[model samples]
Target: MMLLDLFAVIAAAVLSVRGAPALTQDPQAAERPTAGVFVATDLNWGGDTLWIPDASNGSCIVLPAPFYQGTSSFGPDKGIACSLWYHDDCDSRNPSFGPLRTPGVSTQADWSNATYNPNSIDNNGIAPNSWDKQVTAFNCWNVGEDGLHID
Candidate 1:
């Protein structure tokens, strides 16, 4: 996203939270900001949706309450991406959702390659290991290629 566009989104979000009307000539033309992960309460992408802003670099941010215990579905929007962990502090271990690459390594799938099916993800072959509705924490960063591994 462009600097001006990002600034506009931040300003608008602040205004909206402060109960101030947004500054726009046409209310219908103002697009909702799409610079973060979109988490839904219902499976198949339904029910309440929350837009979580990008986490500062290398920061281990915990998921918000209610969602901290479980999340039905989640997808990252353009410009920003992240990975979820079954435990707080971004630790993907046994019984935790992880990236699908190595045969049995605990890593999270990249945002661009997310399948959006927590249940299908390989956490293990058991209960909490199924990865369905089992997210406790996460890490996020702006999607960029420079100095970043695509895998």
Candidate 2:
């Protein structure tokens, strides 16, 4: 996102949190921000990076570009930080429900040429292994990627 756009988002978020009359309608209907996909060049959510914004709740997003070989995060939007996993196939076993997090070792020349199937993910920042690079599918929110709730 652009700097101004990001700033606007932050400002709006602050306003919403602080109860801006126009922005605040039903207090009980408030929502939390969603942290989308974050990629790092190194392991353990470290190194140079790139990030994709959160997809809408219950929506599936297939990356059309290349972003292979790196660590990942669920972002800090939710109340509690949690561990998450990713899958390679978009089948019954690898249903598209829940966010993705992973770090992997890839030998591909670039993001496009690289295969991204991160076998495992560790959001607790304590997994012994890195993310797998052979990935095609991932986990995301069961409801939507817009709220703070985890399922």
Candidate 3:
């Protein structure tokens, strides 16, 4: 009986020590950031978007072209403002993922440049908008399980 008890204790200790790293390691760890492409269309603007980590670069997150529209900002008059949103760890490297014209505007005419607006909004700024015509865009990526939901 004494030998059996000692063996069980030793086994438990060894298992615990061996399993510590696996248990502590983040299961949802984001892969190294890299350059990737995503597209947002008129149909799914209100739905959620996913941000998969890039395997190439360790600190960059690629955004889709239509990720931000000027009109989606303060009001309809502003149009779609070119913007990017990601975790603070993301570094913007690709310009193509930045911004471009909306298609109808002449290529010759210089318009407003798409801004690098980070989607890292604080909890206090998430109040619901009262405007009827406003088209609000959200950053569904990188949000943990406790994030707020858009109705």
Candidate 4:
């Protein structure tokens, strides 16, 4: 029927328009950027986004603002660099969900001053180190006001 054909055409057009970057699956993909922790900066994920938690930890990236401008500039003075870690919300190791493997940081004060590095290659949940792939459906976390940020 004409209606069926029209429906197919419409569906095809919709799919075409909805096309976005395909996330990778291999965590060690060379195209992926190295993970790093940024401090004292509000993240701009290009557009509004949410963090999907995984069984081991939550992984997400905050694309710098002026997204289309192809610039790496962030924060007033730029962000501070730090290490990375993975921890679940319910993780007994670090219940607050922060960097788990910080160098030279062993106490609360150290943690406060430590940097958190997220897996950049895992942003799309492709790489072996993907963080958000295991998130429960409809469950997500938002960035904080004054805490560590990752990309």
Q: What is the overall TM-score of model 4 with all chains considered together?
A: 0.20
Over the stretch 37-70, how does candidate 1's per-residue lDDT look in tens digits?
5555545444444556544254677777656755
Candidate 4 lDDT at 141 equals 29
Tens-digit lDDT string for candidate 3 (1-151): 9999999898889656543212111212323234222222222222222333232222333333343332222100011212232222233331111232122111111223333333434322322222111112222222123432222
Judged by TM-score, which candidate is best?
1
Q: Which is superior by TM-score, 1 or 4?
A: 1
Prediction RMSDs, each to the true structure: 11.0, 13.0, 18.9, 16.1
Off by over 4 Å in 2: 1-34, 68-76, 79-89, 95-131, 142-151
Model 4, 60-132: lDDT tens digits are 3332332222211111111222212232222323212233321212233433443323323233332233222
lDDT values, one for every candidate: 0.49, 0.36, 0.27, 0.27
TM per candidate: 0.50, 0.35, 0.17, 0.20
Which is superior by lDDT, 1 or 4? 1
Worst 10 residues of 4 by lDDT: 69-78
lDDT of 4 at 134: 24
Comparing candidate 2 with candidate 3, which one achieves the higher lDDT?
Answer: 2
- Can you give the lDDT of residue 9 in candidate 1? 94
